[model samples]
Target chain A: MSVDIKKYLEEKQQLVDGYLEANLPPIGTPPTVLHESIRYSLLAGGKRIRPILTVAAAESIGPPPKALLPVACAFEFIHTYSLIHDDLPAMDNDDFRRGKPTNHKVYGDGMAILAGDGLQTMAFEWCSRVDLVNDIEPYVQVQIIAELAHGSGNQGMVGGQVLDIQAENTKVDFAEIQNIHAHKTGKLIRAAVRAGALLSGANLTQFDQLTAYAEDIGLAFQIADDVLNVTGTREELGKDANTDAERGKQTYPSFYGLKGAKKLAQECADRAISRLSSFDEKADPLRGIAQYIVSRRN
Target chain B: MSVDIKKYLEEKQQLVDGYLEANLPPIGTPPTVLHESIRYSLLAGGKRIRPILTVAAAESIGPPPKALLPVACAFEFIHTYSLIHDDLPAMDNDDFRRGKPTNHKVYGDGMAILAGDGLQTMAFEWCSRVDLVNDIEPYVQVQIIAELAHGSGNQGMVGGQVLDIQAENTKVDFAEIQNIHAHKTGKLIRAAVRAGALLSGANLTQFDQLTAYAEDIGLAFQIADDVLNVTGTREELGKDANTDAERGKQTYPSFYGLKGAKKLAQECADRAISRLSSFDEKADPLRGIAQYIVSRRN
Candidate 1:
């Protein structure tokens, strides 16, 4: 099962990588610094997890994975913007991300800031341009925009970021940590999955089931991140590790301890798999993704 | 004519102010700094020019100004976000905006970045919620989002910001400056006008004419800004003035000299008012706004 997950993610990542590279704004224009900053962070290697999930969800419907490339690319835009802003001097303040200097470190704070802004707007632009697809209805487009907004706005990632910042150097409870992670990481990940479902016109019942699966996997992914932060090395992670403990950031390991956090992550993965038990073999990728969330080294 | 323009702007400002204050997210539980950053920059005193234009454009058609409040508020969100990002350490590095500490200065760069991101997302959310208005058709809502997206995206403000950043410390031609100003400031201003017109169901002919007027005023506004940056005092501007030349920024005054820049502004304003002469009394506010663009002190 784990081997299948690796193969699946690798295949999907190639597709996502192609879409991302092709869709990014062309380089060499004025504000070249800002555009280059965005492209740098975007093209910097990651697992492409959100986009892969988007493709999987879309494929779970009758549509070909190729049909969902725009949405997959758009989700990456939102995700990349979050990372760029997250690593800013005032936020996480990390100098490096994914083994390279963070956007602000390389491009200066001003252009880095605008790069994030440009990327966020670009996500919506990509969605609007998807009107060329006959299967994607206008109302669905509106729904995707609304979901992306809510996931990224005050009530979601921004809210979680606030909690994260506030949680710094403070003793925080499990519930608050859960709430922060749920909004910060969970909402957008869930939205990515649901956006794929939306593109395929999933019924409400299927959406609810998928939402449950997404919620489980999303939390599991964060927990695994916490675990990796404590356990992985810089070479393996391709960036700073254990920086959470260094910064005293609220993490699963901080509250529950490493072993306990691992246990929680497994439980989440289990719940995520259980949610798709009713589905046919088509749900295998979803299950594989959930397992991948917990088992990956970085 | 100038007196009438002043009165119209003041009246529209009052309405826009009331709506903006009412729409601001309440300081609530969690008390995150990002929320405060957003509110601080948004509520900070300015002329409320963009929102006022939105309302004025709507009124130029048939309805009372109240009907356009959502669209007006949306413009304010975009404008406030731009200001917040512009004040970041990497950009202007300004400590103050609108006579107060900038958002990043008060809230820190990370939260300020998030505040801008949240506000940008909220703009579209506000547009989505315009479903409550019986007067706006669904197609018009789509059009409004499209215009806002285009005006705010890489092709618009973001693109202009990139160009402006690139032009910094580099010799740029007058056409390059015009292109930068058109995307950075003109597009949104024009969109604000077009959005209001579309919301009010203005005929295509009137929409096209109003757009032309908006484009002229928008360019005039930038030229005036360039002129003022050189000639105005910091005490009068409530923010840094002459900082453009100090930073080696490319501005109208930098290339054409102050006198030439002022003349260009006047020409742009003339074109703006010329587009409105075809309308009767309803266009008085628009005409006044064009004149005020070239004449205002700050």
Candidate 2:
């Protein structure tokens, strides 16, 4: 039976939100404005897809462990920090994100930078903290830290951002765009899934299968985003639509056209679902998420 | 017999520079610009005091492990990242650091921001990677990661920077300045020493003694910096003289007169050296560092 994907997402998002709220430094902490600024954007809402992938992937392996929450939330922190830094005046210069002013717009550039920096370090803090996730083997904790760093650092997300920025207003071929997407958004998404599997003690076959599933979905997710920029309304996208083209940024649609991009995205989702076919219905949420990723308006 | 402090520092600095050179992503990497920006600032020479402290602290306990280099370099990454971010136009807007154009001044603000982000994550990567430091126990690695995150994150370095920025051009009490120094710069310094001791397998007693020593020297180091800002020439400071007052930032010298600040620094150095009195001659470098912290012109 198909899962109620919407309800599952909402529930997972709530779980993650609760963890973040309970764990983050209180607003009244010394350096009040720093904590306040961190909360301001971090508490601001999004789909929570990155962290939800972590939870869903872990569930697919087995009943997810208690340690899953902190690891899951770590991905969210990384994602949130990237978003904050990305929207900075020095970077993407976006005024709004998810229907509110970006962190830099609200907190000024300096505090926004520090807020992003704070969140990034906080992610490692959450993952490495023995007190928070005592059930995790020390080796596993170190592995998770390594995974997060590899996915988020220069060779992955940061490097991808550099490619994306350089690609803007330049003639970029398919391979270049692919390189940008693979490293930029795709790696972290893959990391989220891999971390979940690693934490849940997946076997080699299961880890590889999940890795394949994640790769397909990560590409699908990015393609869907590219398509949305062209076809979706501002309200549906939560920010200005077609801004990719406005900025002369290359996307799947820039090469493939809207219909082709949508077709590619659906193909990716199908492949992703197929990769998880060996798993039983315990993975239904993951299957539904793949379907949802390609079809959702936002 | 006294240690040759000058020669010891030069040797340690060279060791750290060699590690950095051999390990960082080559300039020809795919995202060449990001790596270049990271190298531009990271390779720019400094005293490497933080890392040398780590090495010397490890030596004080016993033979330093292979893991010591990575853990030691991690502090420099944190330090250099702080410097890069501090030099951003949005923050301190510093034009130069250590006699050269700052990261933002050369790489532009966006890449400089990403470079800082890269180095920060790289610090975690260096700590977590089992390959780089295989001799270290996984739990010890995790502990080092936790220590670094604690020392550098909001409640420590980042939080201190926020306080420093807020305190600019404002009347501040002695307690406030003390708070700023303890968090902003002091915590990371302490973390450097603690990580060194932890990696070197220092006993609890040795760890406690070294931590006290680190704390004393950290405060002494900050006080010396304040006095230098006021008294040293631009050449000696490698930037500008009286820039602390130029920025309307308060310092130890601002509260206590220069003479009083110098006296306080010496007293801290004395306390720091006293804390290490129980250790044998192996800790001579650490002893020398404490004395050097208060006495150096820059």
Candidate 3:
């Protein structure tokens, strides 16, 4: 079953890859250091899951996946900016991310920081300028801005990050940990899904279902991350593994044991799929994505 | 003449100061490190020129200065965030800003970076929630976001910063330097003034005249900054003076002599005041602000 999930993800990843490469800020003549830093992290290899989910969600409601490329790229821009900033000397302070020296490590922190800021502003600029083909309403554009703003603002990702930083070296309860993960990671992921649905003019019923699916998978995704951090080897993960434990950071595997963490992830995967039952075959890609979240090794 | 300008600015500064202090994010109970970094930089003393201009511009058109407090506050948030980021290790690499240790110096690079990111998001969040009394139109809110996005985006301040970085130690011509300053610093100043006027529903005639005044003063403001960088004492300036020459950064005083720069600034002030001639006595505050820009010691 997991092998099938991998194959499906590969296909979706290819589609997302084409869209991302096409949408990136072009490497123009006399490209500045800031532009290079932005491109470096954006083009760095990843599963491209957030963008894929965006397109998949849009498809689940209405419209071809290609039409949503600008928004999908915007999601990638925000995700890449977060990763670049997170890897900076002041934050997670990681020297490497995704098997490469992080943006700050390669480009220096000043350009890296500006690159992140530029990408973030560019994300909204891209969304605002997207040609909606007369299908999406102007209010939908406003909605996208509002959703992205909330997902990225103090009450969402930034707040979650504050809690995460404060949680360092301290034991936080499961509820607190879950809340941190929900806002820190879950909000953007959920926003990606909803952005896609909203672009396609999703009705309230469909939005509610998609929201449930996104919330379940987002949590499951983080649980699997915790599981991988403890259980996977560096060679398999292509980056540091078990470093969280070494740093004394809280994780499900630390508090509940590896087996318990795996069980929780499986339950989340089940719940994620159940939320998609109301949709027709259009949601199969999302269902496949949820299963991939819990079962992947890397 | 200068005495009256100083007195008027002092009064405007007092009002802006009280409003900003009131708006500062409360020291969170058990304040997170990042929150502290944000508050520290936000409260550090400056002239409060940007917010005051916002209020004064609005008042010059139709309403009392108090009506634009929320928009004024939003402008301050954006200004403060830019200053924090500009002082970071990757950008200006300054040790002090406004007579205080720079945010990155005080809070470490990571927290300072997040603080800047948090403040930028907070600006928009503040705008979204502002109590629009005096029947400010909803479309005006949309226009504010659009104008702000343009001013802060690649075509505006960020673009100017990038150009400034590239021009460092290079023998750039006067026109290129002026373009950079106009975009980098002038755009936001102009936006601040225009935003105020737009909020008050100023007509096209008022818009044209106000924008011309803003453009003149924006450049005048930068010329004054260059003059201060070269001529002002460090203790009086709060931040380091002559740091531009020390860093091999381009400045009006560096290209044109200090005397020439001062002359240019005075001309800019003259032009700015002349643009407001069509207005009645109500525009006196704006004319005084232009004079203050040229004569300010810090």
For residue A163, model 1's alpha carbon misses the true position, in angstroms, by: 1.2
Question: Model 2 off-target regions past 4 Å?
Answer: none
Interface Cα RMSD, each model: 2.5, 1.2, 3.5
Better of 1 and 3 by lDDT: 1
lDDT of 3 at A123: 69
| Cα lDDT tens digits for candidate 3, B181-246 | 888899889988998888778899999999999999999999999899988887888889899999
Candidates, ranked, DockQ: 2, 1, 3
Residue by residue across A1-298, what tens digits does model 3's lDDT show? 2235567668777877786667665666123566777778887788888888888898887675344777777778878888888888778888777888888888877778777877777666666553553545545665666677677767677777877887899978988889889988898899899988988888999999999999999899999999999888877786788889888989888878999999999999899999988888778788888988898888
Q: Is the docking of candidate 3 incorrect, acceptable, medium or high quality?
A: acceptable
Residue A51, candidate 1: how far off, in angstroms? 1.9
Clashes of each: 2, 0, 2
Candidate 1 vs candidate 3, DockQ winner = 1
Question: For each candidate, what's the DockQ?
Answer: 0.50, 0.77, 0.35
Tens digit of lDDT per residue, candidate 2, span B1-298? 3689989999999999999999888779879989998998989888999999999999999997788898999999999999999889899888878888888888889999999999999999999996744698888888899999999999889999999989999999999999999999899999999999998899999999999999999999999999999989988887767889888888999889999999999999999999998899999999999998988988
TM-score: the better of candidates 1 and 2: 2
The TM-score of the first chain in every model comes to 0.95, 0.97, 0.94
